[model samples]
Target: METSTFVKEIAERFSVINRLHPTELLLPLLREIAKGSPVSRKTLATVLDWPADRVAAALDQVPSTEYDDDGNIVGYGLTLRETPHTFEIDGQRLYTWCALDVLIFPALLGRSAYVSSRCPTTGEEVSLTVAPDGLHRLEPASAVVSLVRPNASSDIRCSFCCHVHFFASAAAADDWVAQHEGA
Candidate 1:
């Protein structure tokens, strides 16, 4: 598929996932998580100005929400924990579940980010600055992002996010795409 087509498809699939949950709360929750700290339910409720029970119920609809030992949210799509994809904003280091999250979150949070991730095949680092408007300072100009169609019934983190990655170049991703059989 063409690059634009692939991007559109991936975006659409994620949009579907978003529609399955309460985005009114999810978007703000994501912004809070992006602050590079684990967010407690009480804190989230206060920040959102919603009831604690309402916050708890909304959180239940979001899958793959990583929590700290104290039950504080550490990650959803954007996270405080370490991952292959590193996203830095406002001098704070953070992570994302996948390469696309690095691209997607900037617009969602209305902020720019410096991103770095290793190519799964070449083990070479792929780095870039992504703004709410577009990508910038992408090293290795030929760098590309890998994507997969997510299975709606499965956990998005495992089925889709884990497979999506940054590649140093198209050639570096060819073997991985071949092995994955539909990326």
Candidate 2:
């Protein structure tokens, strides 16, 4: 697939995983995390002039939210502390939960990004430089991108539960697909 098509497909698939509804506070918090800042729940509460419990409750709606020792939201679904999807933007090193995240974040952030990840099946590293224009410096010219939208038609939270894996070859990805029946 062309880089733009690949990126769009990944973004659309992952769009199912997002804030349940428009809230006064949750989306802003998540967007901040998307910009690579670790935000303290308490600070958010204070700044937004919202109750602490209200802030916490809103944050809980976000997927894959990782907290620090002090109850700060260190990671959200689009950003992670440790993961195979590493995004290097400007001078900072950010992380995402999966390969698709690395592919799509540049468009979301409206910034150029340098991303690196590994093929789950072969463990071969794949890297790309994604800009607002397109992808460049992509390694491993041919690769298999496996997209699993588990429970897509169900009421289950698909975004948090879905999987997007990359592989060095179609055969390797097919092997993975065989092992994961539902997902």
Candidate 3:
């Protein structure tokens, strides 16, 4: 498929998945997490200015909400834990569940991010600087992002995010795509 078409299809899938949950709270929660620390339910409640029970109910609707030992959120799409995708903003290191998150969150956060991830097949590094408007710099200008149509009924992180990745180039993704059932 053409790059634009592929991006649009993937974005549409994400939009559908987002609509299933309380997305209004997502931006504020994401903003708090971007401050470089794990966010507690109480802290999230404070950030949203909602009661703790309400915050918990809302968070329960979000899939793959990772928590630390102390019950703090560490990964929600944007993460504080290390992953294949590294996202850095204002010199603070963060991570994301997938390549798409690297592209999307910079705009949501209204901040530029330096992103680094490896091609799943070739192990070659794909790095870029993304601004709120668009890509600022992309190393190996031939690089491309891989995407999958996820099952909406399943956990989004496992069904979609785990399959999405950055490739050094289209050619580099060929073998990997062939191996994965969907990409």
Candidate 4:
């Protein structure tokens, strides 16, 4: 398959897996699952293939964490809810918006609830608010600004999260804020 097609497919899968599991073990879990599936392993290893011994070694290394008891091979992954669906590198990136809450806060100084940039964990933009003592944890962007109500007038797409807040550089975020003051 073409690289972009594969990447997009992987990204979609990652977003699914991430809904259940945390991000740290996403790749390892992917490798473990890939090893068993007939086409899944072959397709993934086609480009990002690893040596057989290396794959075995990595699989062995995956269970070393202290959180879950390491007895069954099938258990112990990035699960937050039930058994986790392992994610590949692409999956990890797809779920990154879920993890980058604090990272995107600076860009979210002035945000709205309806915009796609709100954090899923908090259901709002991760923003600083005045506390009785001083600055504390952030509130979701939604709490700050009401989202534009969906209506027949606008074409709205539902996504896992609203706006994405990745940065090539912090200076770039600064530039973005400077250029789009009310955006």
Best by TM-score: 3
User: What is the TM-score of candidate 2?
Assistant: 0.72
- The lDDT for every candidate, in the order shown, is 0.87, 0.65, 0.88, 0.32
Can you write out model 3's per-residue Cα lDDT over 1-183, one digit (the tens) per residue?
Answer: 787887787777777887776888878978988999999999888888899999888878876888999999988888998999999999999999999999999999999999999988788899999999999999889999887777664367887888899999999988888888757
Taking the tens digit of each residue's C-alpha lDDT, what string does model 1 give over 1-183? 797887788778878887766778767788888877899999999998999999888888777889999999999889898999999998999999999899988998999999999998888989999999989789878999887877663367886889999999999989999998559
Residue 167 in candidate 3, Cα distance off native in Å: 0.4
Report the number of clashing residue pairs per model.
Answer: 0, 0, 0, 10
Best by lDDT: 3
Q: In model 2, state the lDDT of residue 67.
A: 78
TM-score of each: 0.90, 0.72, 0.91, 0.22
- Once fitted onto the true fold, the runs of candidate 1 whose alpha carbons sit more than 4 angstroms away are 1-12
Model 2 is weakest, by summed lDDT over 10 consecutive residues, at 152-161
Deviating ranges (above 4 Å) for candidate 2: 1-27, 34-37, 42-53, 152-162
Query: lDDT, candidate 1, residue 177?
Result: 92
The true-versus-predicted C-alpha distance at residue 22 of model 4, in Å, is: 18
lDDT of 4 by residue, 78-168 (tens): 2222211112222221112222222332232222111123332233333333222333444432233212112221111112222224332
